[model samples]
Target: MRISTFLNVHLVSDSTGETLNAVLRAVAPLFEGVTPLEHSYYLVRSRRQLDRVLAEIESFPGVVLFTIAAHDLRDVLVDHCKRLGIPALPLLDQVLTMWEHHLKMRAGEKTGSKQALDENYFRRIDALNYTMAHDDGQMVHEFNQAEVVLVGVSRTSKTPTSIYLANRGIRTGNFPLVPKAPIPQALLELNKPLVVGLRVSPDRLIAIRRNRLLSLNADATSEYVDEDAVREEITDANRLFERQNWPVIDVTRRSIEETSAAILNLLADRNAK
Candidate 1:
């Protein structure tokens, strides 16, 4: 069994660590089954925590990945990991270098291209930075500024979809629709936003809700996880979306990326009109 340990070193000033986390989370499943990997993430924002995580890395085997923000700290971590005989990968540095070289090469090879690509490139970087800061409800106002809003019952991939859209330069807000609860008055008047409602098959929903209730040590019985009630809630939500002309997405079969891409495509079509 090939076991590897993963460590994440963050910066106190790093505003985009959340975006890096999302990508790593999406790729985590790839390391399962064959090359077994056990990992722990350290959110190091202080010098004391950084020193502690570095010392801890010496006792663990395999890779040490630094989602580093500061250039000086990245050099220190890399040297330390190297001395400890662990492979260290600095993600931000590699990506930025790749992007810079790619754009520079493209500009040099293109005809009549202005130097204004720098502004666009930096803007994209800023967008990604903003995305990291806004992820996980940190920037709820940014969510409200989204061109697309995702509404779901719960665990229907609202958070994942929102993060995915953020990575692709789209601001996305998500709100869960509670059973028998009134829709937010603001949402009812959200004519400027493209709202998308998500649904899943009732059986699937029942299983998911039941598991959730059990995990929370709550009543996993009739009212909350009942199949009939779930079906009715789904139906009602679908009808509400249709009546309001909001695009509906069935998340039962689609992965988070696929569902997010579909929503983005829909928004793109609307913009084209």
Candidate 2:
């Protein structure tokens, strides 16, 4: 195995450092064996905050990525990095410049513009509230209000996927398929929402359940983690999906993001139809 090399990376943002972190994560893997040591500073809107951040950067001396909307603050950061002989980059400057050129206008000076309390932000909040309310088969009578409903056996990642979809302003809910329990009538009758079934391999399900049980300090010998029982559960879930004519996604090797993306595609196709 190749030895790992660590590189210090400084991320400064006037708002949440989500964009910087995401960009770093996307690019870091391309350089094999190089691990990033992240130093993230968020909400660097004031000069004082920027001063503290600069101190940290100077001490560590790393590649700097920032998304400061204030021009003066950005200038100070860039100049300081230049004097220190460290590389400083604005993450959104190129994209914003391209948009400005295309639209024949300069970008606004507003800080943390993406986090503004706009209609889309409110919509995402509403969707998140609805998702939390309807998670794990809760509020089944209101299932029709959801844009998408996920159905799956235990440990198939129903809850996390539902939340992820909700974050994208898609009202999502999920219901678990327990062994020997009859399917909820409300779920079966959800005509308005696109009901998607999540399926996982029996072996993967057992491993997940075993880890879950260990985390909870619960008995691992229960039928919940039994290989035969898990197999039967998955098979029954698959059959139910086929009987109901619902879309099914295998989550055995899929991340929550991947599963949610598939569900979004299914919802888009349904909407088109």
- Can you give the TM-score per candidate against the true fold? 0.56, 0.94
TM-score: model 1 vs. ground truth: 0.56
Candidate 2 structure quality by residue, lDDT tens digits, 1-273: 789988889999998788998899899999999999999999888999999999999888879999998889999999999999999999999999999999999988877756667898899999999999999989999999999999999888899999999989999988999999988888998899999999899888888989999999999999998888888988999999999999999999999999999989988888898
lDDT of 1 at 27: 62
Q: Tens digit of lDDT per residue, candidate 1, span 1-273?
A: 666644433222223345455655666667554342434444455566667767766665566655645556666777888887788776555666787798874212111123225565455455556555644334444555556678878678777787777656665667777789877666766777688889888888888878888888887676767777788888888888888888898999999999988997899899999
Clashing pairs in 2: none
- Taking all chains together, the TM-score of candidate 2 against the true structure is 0.94
Highest TM-score scorer: 2
For each candidate, the alpha-carbon lDDT, in order, equals 0.67, 0.92
Model 1 whole-model lDDT (C-alpha atoms): 0.67
